[model samples]
Target: MVRIKRWLLAALVMSAGVSGFMLTKGTSHAATTDPQTFISTLKSPVTTVANQYKLYPSVMMAQAALESAWGTSTLTTTANNYFGIKGSYNGASVTMKTAEYDSNGQLYYTNANFRKYPSAKASMTDNAKLLRNGTSYNTSIYSGTWRENAATYADAANALTGTYATAPTYGSSLISIIKQYGLNTLLDASASDSSSSNSNSGSTPKPKPVVYSKATYYGASGTQTARLSGQYATYRLYNHVKGTRANITKTAWSKVAAGKNVLVYLDMRGVKKDASTGKKTTWYRIRFAKNTSAKKYWVYTKALTLPTVKYTSGTAAVKVNNTVSGSYYDHVFNSPYLAKSMGALNKLTAKSYVADKQAIKTQDGYKSTWYRIKVGKQAYWIAATETAAAPQYDAVTYSAASGTKKLSAKYSKYTLYNHVKKTHFNQKTYKWPAGSKKGTKVTVNFKGVKTAYKTTWYRIQFNGSQTNYWVDARALA
Candidate 1:
């Protein structure tokens, strides 16, 4: 089942092409050279999605690039579904579908559940939300620093449980795309950096344009083309960061459009200088925003610290189980538990409960209890809720007294009602036996011929004790 699920998930990602793979150095350059037309049409909407959802712009862009090959996939073309999202949308969705597999090793075609949009931009915007909130894949990998132990986006993609085998190199492929285009540059690390700042009273530095295209300078404004504007005391642009000079005299807007999507380098107070290079720098990296209004630029407050290298020697058999202290139930209650009835529990004398096909003695005394029980190397109990009792079999106010019939000793009669499965039927409302009470409402929907069966009859199911049991099921139909 696990293997089949993994394959299905891989198919969804790979079928979409680029989005399935991780961004790494090997595949980045090849995948990133998507057409400019695709970029222009999709880029703006992608940025809008990032800003609205507070997600990293580059990650969104990278996923789109990977999924659609810059709007080239059949899924995207027909359904506007760049992510190959499954079909069965509760609201508006595309009718397009593709063949996939289930965990049972059966193949089926399902309409990919996708939110259809008027344009590729709208699709990009919706895709961001799906990525951030979707349960199938984890969005953490795209947002934060990758951790060693926890599963990230790449791991989640691989862990997916549907047809995803088409994209064999999905994780590595996406990573390659990110590195090639420097797409990870869209995340803002400024907030994390600011946490370590020594200055409490200083104002946060406004960002310098990272990719300014044109500029205007006049009257009271000072301009520098290649470097920092003279208006500010100190300003420096890092990699992927751009600066533009603009004039306030003519009331003209800054000419540096900077390619619409830009990563800005903001100022950080209390930055120190490298004595040898005479360069004033802080631990800063460039992050792109989806649009002009986006909270685009990010500057780190702390200096970049590199971790010390480590080395590992040979051979050792380490203990895999790290269970320090906990009861057996705590370890495996949610997983590997089986459903067993109280009658089956008592009859088992083996090391644990035997698998299906093993016959056991039936005890009428303990029938009300059904347990999600594990009886193997270790026996554990779960889902131990008591089963409800049968309804009363006596005269009632709302009686269906049409054609009453007698039943065989093993046969039970039941009336068809919405709450017939309920254990305690109201004796005042429905016809039932005189001695019946709340504890006798247990009856499985018996499969048999309707004409031969009684419309309503008494069914006695097990309770913990004999006296507590009562006649249950509907009176008559």
Candidate 2:
């Protein structure tokens, strides 16, 4: 009986040993064969998630490979938690041992709860949502402009270090995996497929034109207002039209000068075809801020390039009794360091009101001072050297006995005008300097009402100039 029992035991032992050996071989084979299969399985699901979330597929694939060990981790193989995402998914979860690092970067293992999904697709979708919305696990790391932050695989990979993983080399490891396997090709293929699908649908793809560095404004002409268009160019008050010359110009415009920006506003009223070129040319219009006579003018579309940069627009508080004195140019610039020349000022004058000031430090290390002033409603900057303070004088009454009454305090430091009319073109006439200094005395020869505007006027002889010109009475103090 004992011998029979020993034989049976030996047979049983041999059978058990054979079974164990087969199981080992099977596991080893799976270990060897599963990586490529796992990667292949991930491709479609990862791409789907990436496209839906505007994430880089290469980034998602690399992260999955690293986090799940090519789908071999117990968390991934059994629970389908590819990203080791730790949370409950519709009440499904698994408690597992995970390695983590504290603020000191020390690695340690701990038992924690992890999320479980029904399939790889669910896992990938959940992972994408986690990245898109972020979580308490690493709020600072993932909470940012999702689409812009994940626009590139490099950016997404770099964002994962320290925050997503404890290892400082986590980002580099994922990047290396992506590059080693040429996973970017998958992204290209996906994009090509998307393009093909779009084309097959007969949908036209129109890309927004990139704004280049330089643009010019073609001057406008006639009684028409110029139009400005485009997303950025919409700041200017003008009619917007799609796919027009103005829209194209605005889209491709960039700042050509330091502070000056320009835009070509198309005047639809003055569209004309050139007989010589056999091409249609549009008229462009520009208006000055303060001056009425020179308020609006038009130029041909061929004369100017569209403006690239958006100019700053607003009103500024004027300093009391402050004046700008300088050699004046008919053209006014938006900024002191001129890049954009808006239009001509009404009158060339030695002095005008000082609105604002800015001290600019140039790239070459030179400091420049710029003054802001209003022409009409538009504000502009000029060089500091062009401004001065008006002098104060006591009021004086006009008398025929003197035939040359001392200039009253009110008129002592006023903007001299050539003519006075009701219209702004005539009202804010050419700005001329009447006195050498603020209190400098001048001769008032005659006073009368302007026949055209029904406004009072004063005929005065300035101290320096022998020629006497008519100054408006309302212009006096």
Q: Top TM-score: which candidate number?
A: 2
User: Which regions in candidate 1 have their CA more than 4 angstroms from the true location?
Assistant: 1-37, 87-91, 104-113, 134-169, 186-477
Each prediction's TM-score against the native? 0.30, 0.35
Off by over 4 Å in 2: 1-34, 101-108, 136-151, 199-477
Number of colliding residue pairs in model 1: 56
lDDT of 1 by residue, 1-477 (tens): 011112223224334334422322321221223444444455566666664665545555666666665655555555565555554333656554556677555988765444444455556655555544544443332222121211233333332212232344555665665566655443323322342363475554333222223322111101100112223112222332221211101111132223222323222122334322344533332223333333322122221221121122211111111122212221112111111222332333333221111111112222222122244454333222221111122232223222222323332343323222222222112333454444333343222122333433332332332221223333312
Q: For candidate 1, which ten residues in a row score worst on lDDT?
A: 217-226
